[model samples]
Target: MIAIVSAPTNLGLRPPQPGAVPGTAKAPEALREAGLHARLLGEGATDAGAILPGRYVDHPNRSRNAVRNHEAIVDHARRLAARLVTLTREGRAPLVLGGDCSLLIAAGLASRVARPSGLVHVDGHTDFRHPSNSPEIGALAGEDLAAAVGLHLPEIADIDGLGPYFDRAATAHIGCRRDDEHLDELADTIGLVLPADRVVMHGAARAAADVLELPALDRGFWLQIDVDVMDPQYMPAVDSPDVGGLSPDELIRLLGLLAPRAWGASVTVFDPDLDPTGRHARTIAEIVATGLRDLGRDLAL
Candidate 1:
């Protein structure tokens, strides 16, 4: 069975304004309100409720030495991982509804509980920022990939002594744009680094086929989908929407090909506040439901 777990946390992002909070924390419920829950439920999926996060606080004057809401993020990740472990033990493939890319920490932690796991990260930007690559470092949502691969501070990176959640050789990053600053480093670290142009040239199906060849897939892999992977024209309702990205159709095809094979998956970074008309939520709901409709086929639920 495909179980839906909500991780509504914006603890990883910088505040858009001095006093206001990032609207991404409401993503899970926004998606559900768009009928995602109903569509999945009608298809026999189970609701695993939510793993609520601590309050979002942006201390602009705080030191850049650590991530914002550091304690909250770690606490939330542990709880989320525990929930995922239970669901996976029940033979359920979790479809995590995320608040931002920072949720990848939980996914990475959970994946290692059973056995070594791989990661397929699909996002517009590399999200690979780290102290070595940049001087300024605070928001985790912008540097989740780095944190997951153990390239960040040891605090969140080595939660419960389980650091480097996904082995560098077992990770694949797709959909990053050509101009992404960390592409060179990512190419050297990740098992496979396919930018948007390469994915377009090879085609979505071919891209997925290439990922399936990874040795990590032999054990299983987790899929991380950041909706900003779609073109800004198609999906501008995110924390950071770049100009050059894949089309909705391309993303749907890519996900449809990869979703079924993944042990579980996370969809993140869709800000409903920017989508007042609810059009974007509806689009995301469709993309996620249609793409992940066959999740956990091996269990035959």
Candidate 2:
């Protein structure tokens, strides 16, 4: 069985401008409208619904919205974790839809609660920024991986009183673009990183196969796909767009390889507002559906 959970909160994105269109918050419905739920055809679906985020507020000394919604993000992560545990206990694979990449904190917490787990982080950005690196902590989305590993920010790092959500050795980061100044330092600290350049060199299939070899996969792993990992030309409706990403077909093929092994998965950061024509939404639905269908065949769900 597969359960679809909607986590629509832009607290992580924290658009610089207030009142910006809330497209990411609408991603769950958008993808469902494009037939994601129908394609999965499982035990059933659950609309976890959107978790409304606080208004974005800027702080000269802190990351834009990080402090403003700090408690809310934690509280919501706990709630989401409980939901994930329930679903898993019920024998369903949870397909989490997102508002931004920050939901990783919740996903990690859920993994700890449900079972030992590993993570396959597929994103354009490594999202491993430590709060100490910059006084301004703008958004949790950019620092999720750092927090997950207990690098900084106890609020997120210690979710459910468990720090270092996934063991560093058990995590594999793939498809990150080499843009951040601290990329080298961050990469050194992570378990396995298949950067965009490497993915380009070896292809998504080879890259994914390498990630699967991590010891964390022994107990299954969570698959985290941030749409920005796709080439902007192919998937432009994301919080951050980067050049030289995988094509939609390549992404699907990679997901097909990874999904069967995923204990659960989440699709994050696709903004439907940016995709006014709905072309991007439909494409995302297709990509996710194809992956889930392949996963179903593997699991015989």
Candidate 3:
């Protein structure tokens, strides 16, 4: 039962630069347009019944809305974290769909409840940079992974259910590339990293175990995918795009690789806004759908 959560909010971060291709604000519609409901799982008669209603996480990012009102992003993250827990409990695998890398804050916080679960984060950016590293420049997108893992951000670090957020050492990562100061420390803290090139070669399931070093808790893992993980050429609609990233087939391979089990697994694919031309969008949707289909087949459905 994969329950999809649509979190579409640009949070209105300032442009990276003029003429930069903008990330889309349209995901739910695009998902619909992809014929997802017509096939795979979740919502309106799909094989995996809709366990929870589609809720919008269209919250304001205070930093973008107004620096002083940063409380808004904190508040939203709080509420969204709690809601993610609710969705998870409803028996539908929490599939967090989002507009930015910020989605990880909520998902990572929610994962605390599923303690001892390995975090499998797939993305192009480390997302683990601190505020000091940020120097108040650029958007908050890159700083989230750091905040989620007990960094300088107090808003997320303070969540009651996710104290210490997660086992930094136990956190495993896949598809990492385009490192920044933020990601460098993030990789150090988490201590589990897989470059994009190696990830595809290893294959999703096996690579997931190797990168994460999964053992007894293989069943208990959080599955995360950042839309930017894909090559920008294949997926041109995003807040940030690095020169080298994973391909669509690679993502699909991972999705199919990671989809089958649950010892408490939460799948979050972010930055769908970066999915321009809808080629990547549809490809992502299809990968998600096919992954679910493969999961069903594996489960003997």
CA lDDT scores, all candidates in order: 0.90, 0.77, 0.56
lDDT for each residue of candidate 1 in 237-285, tens digit (9 for 90 to 100): 9989887788888888998988877889999999999999999999999
Residue 279: error of model 1 in Å?
A: 0.2
TM-score of 2: 0.90
Q: Estimate each model's TM-score.
A: 0.97, 0.90, 0.77
lDDT of 3 by residue, 53-148 (tens): 222233334343222224444555666667667756665565655555555666667767643355666777776656566555334455555666
The runs of at least 3 residues in candidate 2 whose Cα sits more than 4 Å from the true structure, single-residue gaps closed, are 19-22, 42-68, 294-301
TM-score of 3: 0.77
| Candidate 1: regions farther than 4 A off | 299-301
Deviation (Å) of 95 in candidate 3: 1.3
